[model samples]
Target: MSEMCPCGALLGESLMPREMAEEGIFSNLLEILMSASSEIEQACKDSNESVDLDTCLLLTAECFRCLRNACVECAKNQHVMRNLGLISTSVHLIKLLHGIQMKEELLLTALRCSLQFLGNIAAGNRDSQNSIWKCAFPDLFLTCLTYNDEKIVAYCCMILFTCLNSEKVRELLDPGNLTVAFHVLKVYKEQLESEWSFLIVTDHLLKCPELVKALYAKLSNQERVTLLELIMVNVNEKNPVTSEEVNVLMTHADFLAGCFQENCEAVLKLTSAADAEDEEALVTIRLLDVLCEMTSNNGQIEHLQSLPGLLETAIDTLRLTHIAGKQAVNIFTATHAMTGQEEISHPAVGFKSHLIRLIGNLCYKNKKNQDKVYELDGIPLILDNCSIDDNNPFVNQWAVYAIRNLTEHNERNQELIAQMEEKGLADNSALESMGLEIEKRDDKLILRSVRKKPS
Candidate 1:
């Protein structure tokens, strides 16, 4: 034991896990781990020999590590350990150590090792996950989450994330337990190693409609902000973005949009710069992004538009940002003149882009929304937003998209744009600057990129 061989690391990183399991090594390690605490207690009782007790504890910890390594990529070994009852033994060992009045380093190491082994075995083994989860839910996991040790907390999160399933999600949704679950998720959110653990769990919970409504009803405003941010990240990071995924968010679009409506008003009233940092403003920005994602789906867009004043509020927020000169000062104070009283500060940058993006998404292929924008005089405002702003990256592109949608197949909207040009009310400078121009091609106004000039 003086020098643990590096190749020992390769013990569980086995390509021949089935063959290794057949060798009966996992059973032997399980025996060592199960008998460890008893062996140490026997050593202490027979004689006050610290070395003997220490050796027994250390050997047990090693057994935990070896079992963890063995189960890493080997489902067979994970099944073997679960069948051999390592789950209950590890749980008992942890409870025993934690109950000790005098905290010891070896005891802590053993507890951490037990947690790590459990997490490893639960990774993708649904049976093992269900077993450990049964022992952990409502109490053990909550206690682990409160621990000060970062490694212990992270391991606990890892296990929770691995074992999370529909049944556990229902238990987690329990009113008494939901808050604790959110607390654990918040803890996981802060840990660098396990940050995605929060997202994974939140994503799963979000898929449950009951959990979604409960979350909204029970979560405080700040917790709601975090939940919204996690939902945004989860949806955005999904590859090949599926319809089922979009549908989950859409199912709760109205609830989320109601949040957007309330927070949008609070954020838009930011007369002083410091108000931008308030929780309302923070939630507003996240809601904007989340709503933007929701509106991207055609299935969700009509429902979002159908929400009373939702479309109007989006346009109004954009108009107010422009009227207040919020977008310009946020990007650059020197480039655009800002009157002291009219200037507005936002909680974070990219607020305008997300806002514009939501408006654009709401208008996508919906003539009623297209007409609504025209009625609210949002066409010129959106056209004005086509100008590039450093704080709101892609605001220009989103604005162009909005204008395109606003005028598509709608003669009234199209003629209004033509009339804006007649009155010089439209700012085509932003579009022209990007080597694009709006022209009437076959009675349909087309915003086409100029081929002669590079865009």
Candidate 2:
């Protein structure tokens, strides 16, 4: 009873989170803000030359810090603070911070606190969240992210993730915010909070078709590929038909398939400036993973099979290749055989194997893709990979299985393999020349035997 009384309360209860953020506390904070605002305004007018407004910046930052502390747990405090016009004031402070000449410490600190203050005000308050949207906060925060200071960029990620929770914020950011948000997810995902903030926002966007359409229109080719990788990891459907995002994504009309096609071109240009990191194999693997996931559905197989150059891209990726000195080299890549010491197959081998499986899956019941695979010179490549014990054995096993799948009932492919076999004996066959044998399995043309598991 004594503790509940305001006068005789325990110190912990003296200021209910609400009382600690009382109108009087707000008034004092507002006074400090007003003082800092005037000083910043004066400095802005006095200096056209960029010079640090050391005292002015610190005071403005401290004002935001105080308000942030006060509003930490109290929803009404956020409401009251935003109603007091602090949202606009924080925006102005951000503008001032961007404009003023300042030391790195002061500028970074001011930006962090000012943005943090905006985020705090947005907590659980729809009107305050919308207030942030109406202001230039998103654009400003995105701009700060490109400055390449990881800490500062990370704070921007946190702020954007926090404030952009409401539908109002999504309406304003929709497609465009995805570009900034995903860039952070791609580059700074490791640095984000335990929640994986970037992915959370992106997953939300993917669920909304309108949001994804906007994202599709705004992202660059590389960014699109990066986003595609995240999407692949996200839409991990064991039974893909049951998934909403995947179903919605499929409705986008070759949107994802086109992304895969572009990713292949990007990988093919492994030496081009366009593929700076030479992440070709990695991106190639990501595309294959997504395709495999999509093809798992009986409905999606035909759709992916129909994407021109998509299956062909998978076929092209199956070739044994390596990156050497900024050039993509076609190599025997017989790691263990050549080194006289067993070495692991390059990751490209595994990715190539995944591509074979994807194409194989696409051809499951789709004759057009089977024909397309046949036309893409896929027969020779498929047979060449039939018994590769030197590198990854699964590459050989999946290749053999793919050949079986491709030729399951397709007479045209069967005929092509038979002709290739006849030619193999007449001349040094592409298969025999490479020292691989072609065997006829009752109704199938395949390697006599493949290492079913890794060698």
lDDT agreement with native, every candidate:
0.70, 0.61
Please list the residue runs of candidate 2 whose C-alpha ends up more than 4 Å from where it truly belongs after superposition: 1-15, 47-59, 104-107, 147-149, 165-197, 204-225, 237-244, 251-253, 259-293, 296-302, 316-329, 332-351, 371-377, 389-393, 407-455
lDDT by residue (1-455, candidate 1, tens digit) is: 23221212344335465336553787787678667767655554556544455566678778888777777657877887888888988887676555544456776777788888887788778899889977767678777887778777777777777788777788877787886567665675567467635755565777776777787677666767777877777666653257766666666677778877766866654545646567766677778888888677655567777778888888888777666665444332212234434533445566667777787777778888889888898887777777766556567778777767776777787777766765677776765654456687785665555654543
Model 2 C-alpha lDDT per residue in residues 326-379, reported as the tens digit of each score: 143232232335454666544344555666788788788778888888878887
Q: Which stretches of candidate 1 lie above 4 Å from their native place?
A: 1-56, 66-84, 101-104, 195-199, 216-223, 239-246, 297-308, 326-346, 384-394, 427-455
User: In candidate 2, where is summed lDDT lowest over 10 consecutive residues?
Assistant: 1-10
Q: Per-candidate TM vs. native?
A: 0.77, 0.69
